[model samples]
Structures are given as structure tokens and as C-alpha cells.
Target chain A: MSMTKLTLQIDGRSIETESGRTILEVCKENDITILTMCHLKGITDVGACRLCLVEIEGVSKLMSACTTKVADKMIIRTSTEKIKRYQRITTELFAAERNHVCSVCIANGHCELQKLAYDVKMDHIRYPYLFPQCEVDTSHPLYVLDHNRCIVCTRCVRVCAEVEGAYNWDVMNRGTNVRIISDFNTPWGESITCSDCGKCVEACPTGALWPKAVVQGQLNKAPEFISDLIEKRKMKL
Target chain B: MRVRKAKKEAEISKNDPRVKFLANKIKKENYSPGSLIEILHTAQNAFGYLPLNVLQYITKALKLPPARVFSTVTFYHFFSLKSKGEHTCLVCTGTACYVKGAQAIVNELEKQFGLHSGQVTPDNKLGVAVARCIGACGIAPAVVLDDEVLAKVEPQELTQKIKSKLAAS
Candidate 1:
């Protein structure tokens, strides 16, 4: 089975890519910047976060680049005025939806959500801050799950199921009340299925899931390791 | 006596049709993950809310990660993993109602019936839930009691209505 080569236009630049590659992949390969969340390299793309939304010429609604596979001669504009406006709004919503006080967060200096806000140049959030009381689960001996800083990206949820095969992390409730939980909404330490592998902590994009050893501003996460692990596993297959 | 009580409790739970019904639902779907939401809907219908054990049972039966089942359950407003009361009341918190003092009604319900938002009364008589907008913005400060909607409502009136209804019924 020979793979077919295809071409797509991104941000008015013509880029050649493979037939089945996603727009996000093409952009990444050719050094075109497209903001993303809920798109970890190793796992499947759920498009839970709307930051990666792009404007395609023929499409009426914005589509997430991570999930939309590239087609021949597709014209994509990632940094259009409309795309930029939505990106800013999406970034603001992420900040306003949760209690992401950067000064107090564990991943204050090293968080992707923070970098995303900076990338989008989000100076102030327009939406009213929903200071809904959330919890900090210190039930796990080695890690902590802070609900306040979580963006509900489900990165931990995906990493646990896709890579580690442990299926421990989960979420409960609906809009404005959604919460990440472990094993039927139990404490992470009390989970019967968790492997204590800490893959979820690394996969987390915010201070929501951090090791107990790391204090605020001192934490380091290697989410790229997830992609590396996936790439390595592919060698065996 | 304690052992006898435990035995009776176990027997009661064992006889619950929902447990068997959920098991049968999984079998009926041939253990496909696509039917997970439907199975959960049936479970919620049979059991009123999704309990931890029931979710665990569904996860194991469907061969799904518990997180996957939980995310699905949490994503929808129709599903509840916690127990609810026999009767339910919803307060509309749309902008019109919010300006018209819907929060006051919620407070009165809390103070009078000890019903907080997203919680059931201790006696299992009532549950209180909040709605962002139930399309009743025309009638500001609306309250929905079970299937009945009370428009242009006040705290005192809602309290009195609920109290009288509960007392009478």
C-alpha cells in the first residue's frame, strides 16, 4: 500500500503533505503555529478544547485542525481575524471557567494554559469569573489533583487509558459543575485500577495534576514523553 | 442481630432488578461501547441516579475504562451519579430571573426546606436544582416544581406553595 502525497494551503502558503495527515500535522511539519489543547500526540484527538479551531475556505463553521484530516488542495487559514478573535475568546473562557490564579498555581511558570494565554495575548478576561468552589484531592500519596486549575482537557484521562492502560481518571457532573474524578468519582489513592505510573501527571497541561514533591513554580512536566512513548510502541507493532 | 441485619440488607440489594437489568442491557448490546450511553440512561431510569457500584459494573461489563464511562456520565445534565429525592424543584437563573431575585427564592428554599442546589433533602422529600435558563425568561423568577412551573414567583410564595403541597400530599 503506497501512501499518496497531497497538498494543502495554510495561511496562504502552499504546503505539501501526505494524503491522510491532519491539518494540524501538516502545520506542525511545515512550522505553522496552530494553538491546541486536548490534542496529545500519543492519544486520539477528542477536540474537547476549541483553541485549535481553524477557518477552511469551503467550511462555514470553524473546524479543529487536529481532528480534520487534510484533503487535496484544501485552503486553511489558521491566523485569520475570525480565528484570532475566537482563539482569544477560547483562551479567556479557559481562564474564566476555572480558578486559574497564576500566582498560586503549582505550574505557574510552566503551564501550557498560561503559555496559551500569553500566546493569544489574553490581557484580561471579559467573562465573569465563575468562582465555583472546587476541591483539591490530596488522596494520592504521590500526586495531587487540584480541581481549581483544571481545564477539563482530559489529557490525564486519555493518557491513562491509551498509554498506561490503567483507566483510573474520570470526570463527573455537567457544564459549570464538571469535575475530574478517579475510578467512579473516588479519590485517586483509593482507585482500584490506578497503576501509580504518574503518566497522567506528566500528561496534564496545567497545575491540576502535580506530583506531591513539587511546589508551585518548581514543577517540570514532559508531555512530549507521551509522544515518544507512542512512537516507541509503534516500532513493536 | 447485626449479622441478621447485614444479611437482610444484602438480600434486599441482591433482589434489586436494576443490577440484573444493567447486566442484561450489556448482553443485549453485545458488550459494545457504542451502547454505553443508552445502558447508562436505562441504569439511571432504573436506579434514579448512577451509583459508583453500578458504574463499575457497566465499565467491567462493557470492557471500558471507568474514566470513559464517568466522563460520559458527567458530560450530560440528564445523568446524575448522586442520589436525588422523590420530588424535584428547579429554579431558573436566567438574566431576567436573576435580576428579578431568583437567588432569593433559592435561599428561601434552602432556609425553609433545607434544600440546597444540586442536593436532596435529608428526609428524601425534595431535591433542588438550578437551571441557567429554562426558556421561562418571559416569566421572570420562575420556579419549576416537578412537572409544574410557577411563573413570576416570589420567595415567600414558593415556600408557602411547597410547604402546603408537601403537607397536603
Candidate 2:
């Protein structure tokens, strides 16, 4: 079946993309900037993070680029004054909602949240720090879960369930009280269902999940490998 | 996969009775994913709390992911994973209740019984819960003791009521 390709204007540039392509995909392919955090390529996009929100013409509220499929002649604005303001506010809120002291974090320089702050040019958080006494679970022999740094993007939960095929991580509660918990709200080290494959640690956008093998500031993660693994699974050989 | 089986067996070993009960319920639901929440409700009603074994059993019997099961259990406040005390007290802390001095009641209870909201007393006689609203906004600062709703409460009087309620239970 031959489908018609749609032409859309984004950031004042006209681009042609076929149907079923997400705005984020088209933007990334054409080198258009669209910031995102909760997006993991192999898993389903829940659009949990509001950072990828873009303003569409004639639409009152913003829509997430990762979840919004490209439509014919859709005039999307990925970067605008209002979008930038919302992005900055989102970054600052993520920083303030949890204990995100950059200097002490394991992800430090390699962290997506830190890079996002720089991308948005966030000098400091204007909001009061919640300073929630979040827990750090060193239960697993190879990984640690720091709730203080968690943005609750659910990437770990998605990757564990989708890619690793081990549905161990999940979020409990709602709003500010929400937390990512291991099987049945048990400690990670005590999880009976976790395969301890480290996919979730690699899939995490922030320093919320990390391998115990690496010390602070020395940790490195390649989230793109998640997509590569998924693609490699398609081959029968 | 062998490791997964081993861990699952170990989890089911201790909680065999409850796990089997949940498995039976899931089977009765015909292993339908749509009935997960309903099955969980029955499981919680039977055990008073949804434990890991029950959740895991539900996952296996329903052929669903454990994360999905765990997510459903945690998304709602109606389901509790922690065991509760003999008597339960749900205190409303909505805007109407707060304006009507709901914090004072919670603080007074915390002081008098050394119990914070959502905590069970050490003796396991009373459990205090903090809820957003119980829909009885007209009766601000409402307290629900078991199935009964007590409206327009005073902190000291509420404390005495809880004490007597616990004593009765």
C-alpha cells in the first residue's frame, strides 16, 4: 500500500515525513532540537515527562512530540518562547522536587538531567527545595536505586518490562508521593522477580539507577544501545 | 529463565496458601487481564494487604507482567501492601478539612498515641490514615472510624474516641 508523505513545518523549516513517524523521530533525524527525558526507544512512550511538549497550531494545550504521531501539514513548533519557558520550568521543577545536588551525584557530568539543565540554560531552581528524605537501596549486588534523584519517568520500569522481559520495577503512590519500587514494593536486593540484568540501570535518564561497579562521576551509560538491542532482536540469525 | 523459576518458587514457598488463593481467584476470572483489579480487590479483602507473593501469583496466573500488577496495586490508595491494625481511622485532610483544623487533629493523635498518619500503633490496636478527602466536605475535618464517619471533631475528643475505639476492638 502506497501512503502519502506529509509535509510539516517545524521551527520554520518545512520537512517531509511519512505517516506513523513521531515528531520526535522526525526532529531527531533532521537534527531539529526537541528535549526529552522519559523516552526510551525500545519501550512504549508514556510521555511521563513533560519536557518534550510542543505547541501545535490551533491546539490550546501543548502535546508531547514523542507520543504525537506526525500528521499531514501539521504546523508544529518545537522551539518557541513559551515552549522554552515551559522547558526551563520543567527542568527546574525536576531539580527542586528531588535531591539533585550535581556535585554528589554518580551521573554527574554524564547525566541527562544535568545536560538538560544546561540545554535549557537553567541557572538555579527558583522553587523551594523539597529535600524529601528519599531512600537509597543498595540491596542488589550490582545496582543502587536512589529515590532522591528519581524524576519518576518510569523508564526503568518500562525497560525492565519491555526489553529485559522482567517486570520488576514499578511506581507506587501518586503525585509527589509516587516512588519506583521493586517487586511488590520490596527492596531491589530482595526482589524475587528481577533478573538483575542491568538494563534498567542503563535505561535510567538520571542518577536514580546505577551500577554498583562504578563510583560517582565515573559512571557511563549508553541508552541508545537499548534501541540497538531491540533492532538486533529482529534478525533471526 | 532457570534463575527466574528458582526465585519464584522460593517466593511462593512461604506464602503458599495466600498465593494459591490468589491463583484460584485469577483462574476464576478466567485469566482475563481486564479483571486484574477486581481479582486484586478480592485478594486484598481476603488477606487485608496485597503481598509480593499474591501479586506474583496474580502475574503468573493472568499471564501478565509483574510490573503491571505491581503498578495497579500501588496506583490506588484503596489497596495497601502493609498490614493494618485491628481498628482503622481515616482522617480527611482536604482543603476544607485543613481550613477546619485537620492538622491539629493529626498532630494531636501523633502526640498522644505516638502514631503518625498511615501508621499502625506498635500494639497493632489502631491504624491512622491520612486521606485527601472523603467526599464529606460539608462535614469538614471528618474522621472515619471503621465504617462510621465522625464529623466536626475536636483533637482531644477525637483522641479519646480513638482510644475507646481501639479498646473496644
Per model, how much of the real contact set is kept? 0.66, 0.51
CA error at residue A116 for candidate 2, angstroms: 1.5
Candidate 2's C-alpha runs over 4 A off are B1-24, B51-53, B91-116, B130-132, B137-143, B149-169
Q: For residues A1-237, what per-residue lDDT tens digits would candidate 1 score against the true structure?
A: 456888888888988777877888889888999999899996999889988999989899999999998999899999989999999999999999978999988898999999999999999999999987999999888899999999999999889888999888777777788888886676777676788889999999999999999877999899999999989988955
Query: What is candidate 2's lDDT per residue for A131-191, written digit by digit as tens?
Result: 9989999978888999999999999888888888878888877889889988667788877
Query: What i-RMS does every model get?
Result: 8.1, 3.2
Candidate 2 backbone overlaps, count:
1
lDDT of 2: 0.86
True contacts kept of 1: 0.66
DockQ of each: 0.34, 0.41
lDDT of 2 at A95: 91
